[model samples]
Target: MELLRTKNLTKVYQQGKHTVNALTDCNIRIEQGEFVAIMGPSGSGKSTLLHLLGALDKPTDGNVWFDGKDMYSLPAEELARIRRQEIGQVFQDFQLIPIMSAYENIITPVLLDKQKPEKEYVEALAERLQIKDRLHHFPAELSGGQKQRVAIARALLMQPKLILADEPTGNLDKESAEEVLNLFIQAVKEAGSTLIMITHDAAIAERAGRVLRIDNGRVTG
Candidate 1:
């Protein structure tokens, strides 16, 4: 039931003579339907690890496997397809298309893949996220919290195998932040989906089933 597994995963960035090792010899397993959080200070490879998990970037060494298939072993086109179908990402910046409404932004994946949106499931997700009424509104017309809710709804609309959130609530106020995190918890619990989140907030990290800290690319005590 390991939805995600990584072994001896490492990432090194060569900047002139000094080589920066973002991650090193790290191994972690996340079970299905689990909500896990990764926490660390800046430059601790928190984002790097999340990126690797989401297949956004390639690892310098070792392997990342989803189910039984090696993620990095796939061809670039296959990896892209897997990223779209199996993994969903919620970024801190709320990367919504400025011209698109909430509804359009959320279903862009389906449209791009030449598949029709599953209307019933998508509506349920929007209602759960409390963004049903705001579907027609552009990102510019929504509050910071509302935008994030829309982002969350979009991520869930696909019913993806795993969702990776990077500092999802970092830009919101306390109440808004709590609302977003609660929505994430509810989604994973209710839908039986897996989540891997990166956050610097200890309070938020405490809500996860498992919390692993990364420092100098290694899981720390």
Candidate 2:
């Protein structure tokens, strides 16, 4: 079944007198439980497309249908709720709160939703990501690879229906990057979550079931 679809999606930004076409009339469909990778060079609007798909940002034109509803047509609160509960995002920057411990960071989503985190599940995720031992440490105390793992654990902690990851392995060394990517694939598969990952590495993109290429704000299979 189709989990997400975009129709004539476009985003534009105004920088002074210049207009930037971040994304342009991109139409794509993603099915449930599929692993998809998007590849593009710098300034290709890859992140812009991901942000639109994940509901992190609204497009300037067209529609995004997630599940069965037109996402942008919904009220802000409902959209926010969907974003919080059904969508999980792993940013390239590893956006963990410095003040929160690794474990605390992982469970932040649940806590934000006023729900209890399942201890067993969180522990299992941490173990799978090889970050169980670093749970008590603060983000400041962890290495770059460890921090990325913590971020992955946090994103998966919610068991969201859709996972949107942007260059998830961008900050790690080759060995660490491979380890994280493999662990990520296994975890996503085990959870039966639909994954849309952005990567610059062709080898990494090949790991996904399907590969989409974007250039100058346009997407092609």
Alpha-carbon TM-score of each model against the true structure: 0.96, 0.97
Name the candidate that leads on TM-score.
2
| lDDT at 90, model 1 | 92
- The worst-scoring run of ten residues by lDDT in candidate 2 lies at 212-221
lDDT string, candidate 1, 1-221, tens digits: 99989999999988999999999988999999998989888999999888898899889998999987899998989888888887888999899999999999999887877789987777788888888899999999999899998888878776788999999999999998998789778976787789989988989888888999888779884
Name the runs in model 1 displaced over 4 angstroms: none
Minimal lDDT window, size 10, model 1: 183-192
* Candidate 2: clashing pairs of residues: none
> lDDT for each of the candidates?
0.88, 0.92
- Residues 159-185, model 2: lDDT tens digits: 899999999998889998998899889
lDDT at position 141, candidate 2? 98
**Model 1 vs truth, CA RMSD:** 1.1
Q: Clashing residue pairs in candidate 1, if any?
A: none
> What lDDT does model 1 reach?
0.88
